[model samples]
Target: MKEDAVDGDPFTTRDVGVAYHAYSASGDVTAPVVYAGSGNPSDYDWLTKQGIDVKGKIVLVRYSVPYSYRGFKALAAEQRGAAGILIYSDPAEDGFKKGRTYPDGPWGPESHIQRGGIGYDFRVPGDPLTPGWASVPGAPRIKAADAASLPKIMSAPLSWRDARPILEALKGPDAPATWQGGLPITYRVGAGPATVHMRVQMDDKVRPIWTVTGRLTGTQSPDQLVIVGNHRDAWVYGGVDPSSGTASLMELARSLGALAKRGTRPKRTIVFASWDAEEFTLTSSTEWGEQHARDLAEHAVAYLNVDSSTSGPDFKASAVPSLNRLVVQSARDILDIEEGTPEMLSNRLGGGSDYTVFLNFLGVPIVDMSFSGPYGVYHSMYDNHRWMQKFGDPGFVRHTAMTRLWGVMALRLANGDVVPLDYRASADRFREFIKEAVQTARLADLPALRPLKAAADRFAIAADRAGLRIETLLAGDPPDPAAAALIDRVLIGTERAFLDSAGIPGRPWYRHLIYAPKATYAPEVLPGVTEALEARDRKQIALQVARLAAALDRAAAILDGSR
Candidate 1:
């Protein structure tokens, strides 16, 4: 390495490194390294003003500050004609800046690296070659080059320690004040002073993924299903990721078996799934969902997904709006060791986990949860049993509490006469979604929005009537089986009613009109409308609005028993 290569920035090269990020193009290149701040569009806009271009350069970007995923950063760089991207974690985002360092506290050490896939799973998850179908043996497939979710540029992960020299080598304008990282050097947006060699080789191959599914057939309605799921795969050992959730699920399953042995069974079937290859591309669950699409559409009552069940003690959850009350009840039922109340339920379901296919693609009601906190060693080797025992979950009391909550929630869904789905929350959320969509688009005169609002209002009315009927049944003697079945049938169709076979515009595989990731970690509200707004096309926006209104009216009709 030349002295001028780093501009005398002192950094010790270490042996610690991660696998080339998934989907990163295999490459060997030596090119000038450019700092693109966080690689967000705004940063690119600033670079344009300084007459800096990233084409054919390897762009250095920090892990999200305002919180965009690494895949988004890579996509942004590739779109700018950058040959490759290196995403490093700054202490300010995930290390010493947050709290004490590892060994003393839960934050990451200087050498920690985050390993993740860089696929545009937000566009379409599962096997990229088989977009709308299962990846079973001999299944129909498409060329990898044509896969929408595949990335075309090289990408890798870096720790701040490894990145300091390159950043210091930059001889350009100081970065925006907000772009300054925790490293001591003056942060600069550089397209010069640093030239480096980078090589990545990956065995990009198609393989089979397995999803292990088990069922406890119901004593009564065996067709109506309550599903519980957790990913079995991990980036590393994944102690605090799926391991915690898996252990809890195993205990829950064991308890369910014990109950069944004692002749006690749920009124509706309970299905437990251990999904494989979630860390790869959300593979197994997505494929399974595609394989059993018709059965799931007809039978799946609700889905409960647990990922990293107890990283700390802060309980957080995301759910479809209709499941709001049920989730709230479960949260209230669980007695956390720390007595921390669950955070407000976020209705947006992100595509980062196994729940994506069920909630977004299949239009099944879903709730995803975790007991998360600031351990900071996420996706690294340090995210292991020692960390979980010492910091993530001392004594594993939180883990036990999670199992209790999960079992209770699943039992409630399975034992309830009418599946316990309350649509008032859905109505309220739809009303709010329309207002937000209108405000987001800044189209006060959008005609489709008016019809959308009308549908929401009617849905609310129907929801209120159904709520009254449910209350009456619960207060009096046990309702007749025929009456309960009628209401349950209608409620089952509520989520399915939101599906549009055309999907959110171009991404037809994501059939749910109501929810999708929309190209980020967290799910966005009114994904179709949001997609149109992102495209800045008024015609598409109007078309999306009309479609959404129709879906809402259809849901309203189901709730009103007029479907």
Candidate 2:
């Protein structure tokens, strides 16, 4: 390493090393550097437009986008013959631009480097070798080298402080306006005067990870399952990410345990899970879900997940629309500790948590909630209890509130005679998604969107009619056991109808048609349709649109009690 004229250290420290999926071989090679902003697919497109060839260069990208996108960037770079990759967090996204630096405020300081996996979570999100199966003690595994989601090129995280010299030394065309960061120097798309030497090494071994599961059997309906889970592992202190959620989970367990001791229990069985290794692509949860796939699919009512429980005062929830009503009802029942009043939980939808397996893979309805406020210290040592006390939850009241809300929601689902699923809401949400997808597809001039639009309309009508029947049933006297069981089965089966046994095009592990991560590393409503359109693959577009339409039609039939 050469000493730069810069005052501070020009190399990332060993303490905050790079993340998973980084190539695990050591070799020294120096090459010219190129600045690739955010490292999103569009950013690569921009580089191509600028006539910049990253081939034989070591690309410098920002850690502003999702981890999966980082992997996409690496794959793109490798395809273009790039030698290596270095990722840094720009102040515009996580540093002083958000607020005062760490030690002064919650934002990251100059040397704060965000470490995370570059694994292709959109393709599959468990142990790489296991893929679609659980990584159990005797589970058959594939060779590590043959894993489809692993990166081929070396990658590392560089603190902005360490990146200053390299960025300043770059010689190329001025970067586009959107490519500029909060750094003081002018951003550039370089094939540079600056060169970087990169290396990476990792241990290839299979290790045991424990998933702590505790169950309380229901006296009346022991077969019905209500599961609530939060991951217990972290890369660092994890105060705002998993620790906060972990604490809330413990509190909920304590409260529930007390009720059970007093002989007051939920009508449906409850399972409390503290999953391990979620940070490495949702490992424990996915494995456990897969291992228990049969029983879960038959009995599980819903999965409620909480990660990064409270980072701020605003209540937010992401869920399949069938569970939206329960989320709303729960939020309305609990007092927002910050505001001293009840407020509606903001609706959000996407992936990046423990709920992925249950909702996207197993087709179980799920609701994930959090209270987020300026979170800049993610995946860093700075995310400690001290930081959480100062910026996340000052009095810990929000944690209690979250626990109470979770309990209420779980209890409501467990004890209700009728499963509280709202097909009308699901239909309405699907309609909205169709409109949005159609508009975006049209803008992209995609010819395959017509089928999706037509299918969504048909599903909407079916869903409305089904919803009316459910309402009529609920409004009358308590249904007989047979009728109640039929309604419950239909409600549970609706999500399952969306699953395609063959799974998505390239990622066989993710089977759901309604929800799956797109290539951009964000969750899409009709993932099959959106991903095919994004790839500009005419054949896939037609194929996925038909699959998505069929899934919706199946869901409608289930909800209408035809299946």
Candidate 3:
């Protein structure tokens, strides 16, 4: 409840303010600390074997471990009894000398600290009070105490200024070279002579989350929906991460709104969302998606996301395999950036933001876009409008550029009579995956590698033949209904192949291709397949490729008006 608890002005407005007191923390406290390396749940195995207990202790976890998510979950399990949580950046990942520090360069200064949530266990996130539903007006809610997955105590962050004293006092094993940071003191993984008191009692107060949605209904296929979203909140002066993207979202809205006002409505309904609670692991979007899971699967066409936009030079996209080409062409048609082409800039997907819920859980095709190169000042006090003006897109020129790009793509998707998803490009991506899968299986000594390889070659040839036909259709005229439906359904099902009812090793909610699925939704998977554990994933992928080729052939026949 203190004024300083919520650090900056941007956090006050709930949507666009700077100070966010989601959790309680202290910077100046001196506490006896223990280093848990990556703080991973697996690390507990090693710690317990050494007879070291982290319960009733303050934990120091280094950032950028192999699996930070797993590490955080382990720390939270300890927090059911831990005194506090202290997370800091390791010099090896991103610290002084690797690059520049802020004001002087792009790296964080000594005072910079990393802050994040310590609860949820990669299962679900929100006001632990509300799960699987919106925290909207008059909604039923559970008490934080009854919230089984909630963290018992609040977590806070400390600057290296505070980290030095605690670390220096410790007397224990010299930390692995990989764990060493920029501090001159010998990094010892410790439980320490660094004894001091630490305490945190967070008020699990409920805060309102805003989801600003604006719609432009299409004239023809109004039932099909195209949604684009970006978060609008910041931890500090979040001008680059959320605000930069937030500004672009605003520009996109204004541009579309202007066009709609001129009677240029799309052929399909388009919804633009400015989400709250994205920084806290996409709470708002995920909860909303969970509440509407069934309806979204039935009606939604595609969801595109733009986060962390700045004046950075290169643009990158991580897409679900289904929309790979559609996303590529749109970026090419929209953005002016040149670096082996935007298509080449695309890469394998990972988890960080809102798209996880839609693609991972609901099986919706998604495209995530952002431009990242150098911004040393992320998640710190310096991530303000001034830093943005001086170092990022000053005066929002890039906002206009991005708006032009987002606008064109949204327009085409929302207005086109036939969904222009290029199945040929999709098949190409599948072919590439087949090649990689074959290599991986050979390396792993898995059987049937040759059969998979032969099947992939046949699929590739079929794809090439289909590619020529689809290209001719694009060059001549849009495909007919039978063709369009065949292509669209195959596109949807092929992308959905990554979904397994079994989900990931620990988390069942993430059933998507590239990221972790949400916990509340049922896994999307192929029907009638024998549910056998230990079946080769490469086998499943190859099977899906063959099915996709068959669907494409059927689509070509339909589009040619021969069906």
Candidate with maximal TM-score: 1
After best superposition, candidate 3 residue 197: deviation in angstroms? 2.2
Which prediction has the highest lDDT against the true structure?
1
Give lDDT per model, in order. 0.82, 0.78, 0.60
For lDDT, candidate 2 versus 3, the one ahead is 2
lDDT of 3 by residue, 282-350 (tens): 777887787787777766788888877764656677775556656667776667444346355443555
Q: Name the candidate, 1 or 2, with the larger lDDT value.
A: 1
**Candidate 3 regions with alpha-carbon error over 4 angstroms:** 1-31, 41-56, 65-83, 90-95, 125-149, 152-154, 338-344, 427-445, 448-469, 475-506, 513-563
Tell me the RMSD of model 1 versus the true structure.
Answer: 4.5
- Compose the digit string of candidate 1's lDDT tens values, residues 43-115: 8988989999899999999887445778888889999999889988889988899898665688877777777
C-alpha displacement of 126 in model 2, angstroms? 0.6
Task: State the local distance difference test value for candidate 3.
Answer: 0.60
For model 1, the superposed segments whose C-alpha errors exceed 4 Å read 1-18, 65-67, 336-342
TM-score of 1: 0.94
RMSD (CA, angstroms), candidate 3: 6.1
lDDT (tens digit, per residue) of candidate 2 on 462-534: 7777777677776777756677778888887888888999998787888988778765556667777777777
Model with the higher TM-score, candidate 1 or 2 = 1
